[model samples]
Target: KTRQKGKKKKKNINLNQSKKQSVSFVCLTCHEKEEIPLSVVRDFDLMDDGDPTTPPMFSCEKCGGRMYPEYYEGVHGIKYRLSDIL
Candidate 1:
């Protein structure tokens, strides 16, 4: 009996990274809007002081003011605003 040798095929791996989503943020003081990465927002939320009442916030590059997500739903399903922080 004769045995045949089989060749192994290499698998094509895709190293391409997925695109991150950009969230819209608005400056509380100046009302200026900008697009920020969702990963960054999640990182900020993770680094927060364990406060579930407040959402992740950022500093406005234009006015040096506080920026919050244009539309954020907290743990209680309530939209948080600058007034909520203050």
Candidate 2:
């Protein structure tokens, strides 16, 4: 009888580490920047009250200021920025 070859081992991958998605945000108030998870941003959008005029935002951990995605466009095709708001 011929000897059978052993099965090859597969590399173990950490899904959490490999599938992590993040976006950079800049705080309009303090100009602080941070990397936020895409999931968190989606959750925020899901909880929003259907305000198409507003853009997704998060609180800055450093300054407690409003942080917006570095490049975001509203539903109305408007690009929002701190300078334009002020």
Candidate 3:
């Protein structure tokens, strides 16, 4: 029974890892809509309050851009253009 529970837990973990995230957002640099992957969400444990559920940084695969996942309050999510990286 113990071993069965362990396997079930592992399966649940895998299910969470297997989740694919895709959202369309305009590239800050190019001003063109791009599909960003959820897997690209990276954790900044030190930068944040150690909340892994909410990833703080995301990179744009198309333009090699990085920005915060801010989409609330008065400001919409800030998008970074390729030039912004420099």
Candidate 4:
């Protein structure tokens, strides 16, 4: 019998580790949009009180006005608008 080379098996990758979860924020005054990591959302305690719809309001660094999550998209293919979440 002749020895033959074989292809190695591929391994599954952690999609979450590859791409970070994030949310999109928009400043009501300046209309500026920023995409931040999900961790930041947690830091802001947006998920507190067991309300996924109501995220804490933030201040815009540029305009000093209120910032809101106009749209939030996660790495796991989840997406929603402020109204949708609410």
Top candidate (TM-score): 1
Q: Model 4: per-residue lDDT, tens digit, 1-86?
A: 12222222111234554354666788878888877777877666634555554565678889898778876543333454666644
Ranking by lDDT: 2, 1, 4, 3
Cα lDDT of model 2 by residue, 1-86, tens digit: 12222222122234445455665788888999988776776676657776766777889998899887775544456565555566
| Model 3 spans > 4 angstroms off | 20-86
Error of 1 at 24 (Å): 0.7
Q: Which pairs in model 3 have colliding backbones?
A: 21-38, 29-81
lDDT of 3 by residue, 1-86 (tens): 99999999999998876553443444445445554454333223234655444334545666766443333111124343333343
Runs with alpha carbons beyond 4 Å of true place in candidate 4: 1-20, 46-53, 72-80, 83-86
TM-score of each: 0.59, 0.57, 0.28, 0.52
State each model's C-alpha RMSD to the native: 9.5, 7.1, 9.8, 7.3
**Candidate 2 residue pairs in clash (backbone atoms < 3 Å):** none
Worst window of 10 by summed lDDT in candidate 1: 7-16
Off by over 4 Å in 2: 1-20, 72-86
Residue 78 lDDT, candidate 3, scale 0-100: 38
Model 4 global lDDT (CA atoms, 0 to 1) = 0.62
- Where does candidate 1 stray beyond 4 Å? 1-20, 73-86
| Clashes per candidate, residues 3 or more apart or on different chains | 0, 0, 2, 0
Decide which is better by lDDT, 2 or 4: 2
If both were scored by TM-score, which would come out higher, candidate 1 or candidate 3?
Answer: 1
